[model samples]
Target chain A: MIMKKTLKFAFQKSLPVLFGYLFLGSAFGIMLQQEGYNFVWALFCSIFIYAGSGQFLLVSLLSGGATLYVTALMTLLINSRHIFYGLSFLDKFKKMRQMYPYMIFSLTDETYSVLCSCSAIGGIDENKALFFIALFDHLYWIAGSVLGSLMGQYLPFDFAGIEFSMTALFVVIFVEQWKSFKSHIPAVVGLVSATVFLLLLGANNFILPSLIVTVTVLMLCKNKVMEKVGGET
Target chain B: MAIDYKTAIAIIAVAAVCTFATRLFPFALFSKSETIPKSVQYLGKVLPPAVIATLVIYCLKDVNLSQFPSGIAELISIALVVGVHAWKKNTLLSIGLGTACYMILIRTVFA
Candidate 1:
């Protein structure tokens, strides 16, 4: 009975991840295939990079013959924010000694969201579940990459418009968070900060600056917001 | 027949090692302190909205906005998503439905 409930809860938690992995991963696969990297390359990149932005950026960088150091530097720049994310859960996860490495490796923006929100004691069992969820996503990306790479060689239809899925996913998350939260501080802070940084930094450099601004603003929003907001999550 | 086995193997092994090192470095390098520093916890609280916002704008950075219809469609979908999320407080339905609407607008009406 307890196992059944855990399964149900885990399913509910990971459903969004499932949707994201399949559609976005499939689309990314098509792109990789069109670029002439075979299925194995796709699988390897998806599993290792495991980051949507970094992987997408890596494809073009590799195609352009960028050096390994250059690619790694760019990847680090894009994903540095994850360092802050990893910090939050270290205390919660230190108990699972054997599982800690895989647990940390699988930490994506999506996985972090799910795991951070979970109220479970966050022991080895929860760590296992989170790892599996990430593994499931990793598999979807590999499968989609293979399908796209093989199919692209023969398929004629345009794969032009699929990148919108990422935006579509973002829109929904923004909306949901906005609606649920009582105070508009977080949403407003995000929108305003992004717009401002987009103006100041242009497209490429805006993220880090905007993140800094958002963090500065939110840190001052009162601690009770997180604790007493009931379902403001 | 077309597979470049050497390049493929190189990419896999190198990327795997590098990736593993990235994930493993923090756990191994850091002292075994269970109690997180206050600064990290503060970041944890501040980062959710900040990250969400970053992901959203990043995706739409190159959106073709010179044309009014696609532009309108984009804004409309964002608005619809916002509306549904605010009213129902449902993440899945809001995102799924909003994406469905976007796909339709782009493929059928805009096409």
Candidate 2:
């Protein structure tokens, strides 16, 4: 009965991620299928790599015949934000015993969002709830990828600009973060740096440079940025 | 278009390893220690807003402004997203409508 209740709670909390992942995960799978891989490959990538945006980029990287070293470096840079997520969870996760590994492995943006607010839910074992949330979210992603790849293989319709959903999702998050924060310096720095780098380096070679410059500039002005935001709040 | 089995496996393995490394870095470094450097904490707090903004621009990297349609499809769709989201503050609505708008524009109007 307790397990049933916990599972119910987990599903309710994961509803938002369920929608987002199914859409984005299937998009990744469809894009992979367009590049000539099958559902098996989609399943493998989703299960192993498990990062949605990184997996999307992986399709292009693989299609381009990028070297192993290049793939490693690019994936690391693209998913670098996960490192920060781990930092904030260190203490909470340590007490979760065996659940720590899976929790760490499944700390995607959506999962983190869900977990951050998880403390508010009363009358449940929080650690078990977290584990179930992580597990369900992972399964949802795998299911979406497999389904999308299968559909892409057999189904016939124009999906030409469907990829724009990824862009739209990012835009929504940017808007949300903009509204949440008092200081806009970091956002401005990111936007300006990326825009300038995109112009100078073109689409193919701008991410690394843009990221480097953004981080450098943010670090240099950390005190001022923090002071401004701190003053506001 | 299929990558060779060996190379494909290698790439997948490398990617999995790299991703796990990032997720595990802080835990491995600070597992026995309680202190997180001040600079690191500051970056943790501030980097997310900026990184997300960077990604938003990164997604638009391929848009061409000098062409005939220019970036009209992208611009129109994004404006709709922003407007809808600002009004409703609904995540799914903004993305679904913006994406649908983009798909329609590209297929019919832009084409």
Candidate 3:
């Protein structure tokens, strides 16, 4: 009974992700298909690597015949923000017991944001909810990509701007976080830092540098930021 | 494609390993400790808001403000997202409406 409720709750929370991942994952699948890879490759990549940006980059890298060393380096750089995600979840996921490794491996940007904002609900086992949320999201991704690969050629709808769903997801999350948190300073710092870097370095190269600066700035402002956490909601 | 099947598989495997390694780095370093250090704990607490903010920017990184549409479509759609979300506090409605609004703008108004 409780298990069913948990599944429903997790599914409710993952609804936004369902739309976002289905579109984005299928887009990846379509891209890979255009490069002559089949659904098998899409399934393989989505199931294994599971990083959206990394997988997209992989399609290009494969087409360009990038060396394994370059592939590794590019993947690391693209996914470097994931390192910070683990930091936030280390203690919470420790209670997940045997599921710890899988939780860590499946921590994509969307999953991380959902987990961050998620709170314990009445009558639901928090661990189970978290686990199911991750699992459902993974399933959605795999299904979307595989479907897209198989049907890429037949799709007639204009998906030219469907990718905006991803942006909407992030914006929704950002607004939620902004409203829930007592201190807006951290968010402001992040926005300022990222925008500055985006302008200075341009889009393709700004992520890593922006992340580095955000972390550094947060570390330096630790005392001030911590002070505002006293009455956090 | 420039790469053969075998080489492509190898590259995918390498990418997977590298991605997992990044996610595992913090746990490998700090999981064994009896208690997480104060500094690390503080970062863990505060990084989410900051990171999410950065991600919002990351999503829009490709929007070229100097171009024809001049990012007007993105600007209006995001404002709608923020506005509708703040008023309704409904995640699904906000995202669905925001995305639909964006698609319409790009396809017609900005096309």
Encode model 3's per-residue lDDT on A31-144: one tens digit a residue: 999998999999999999999999999999999999888998899999988888888988888989989999999999999988998988899989989999999999999999
Please say which candidate is ahead in TM-score: 1 or 2.
1
Candidate lDDT (C-alpha), each: 0.64, 0.80, 0.89
Please give, for residues B1-111, the per-residue lDDT of candidate 1 as tens digits.
233556444544554555545555545545466555565565555455556666777666655555557367677777887787778877677767777777778887777
TM-score of chain B of each: 0.73, 0.80, 0.94
lDDT for A133 in candidate 2 is 88
Model 1, which residues run further than 4 Å from truth?
A116-128, A153-165, A179-184, A219-233, B1-31, B64-70
Q: Model 2 misses residue B90 by how many Å? A: 1.9
Better of 1 and 3 by lDDT: 3
Candidate 3, residue A170: the lDDT equals 86
lDDT of 2 by residue, A1-233 (tens): 77777888888767656756775788888898898888999999999889977898899888988899899999998887676677557777888999998888888866765565355366677778888989899998998898898886564676667667667766777788788787899889989998999899997778778877987898888778878778321
Per-residue lDDT of candidate 1, residues A1-233 (tens digit): 55555566667666666756665666666677666776777777777767776677766765565555765667667666565566556655576677676677777777766565455643325655655665665666666666666665465654435455456556666555554555567667877888788767777777777877777777777475566444323
Model 1's TM-score against the true structure? 0.79
For model 2, what is the error of residue B100's alpha carbon versus the real structure, in angstroms, after optimal superposition?
Answer: 2.0
- Ten-residue segment with the worst summed lDDT in candidate 1 chain A? A224-233
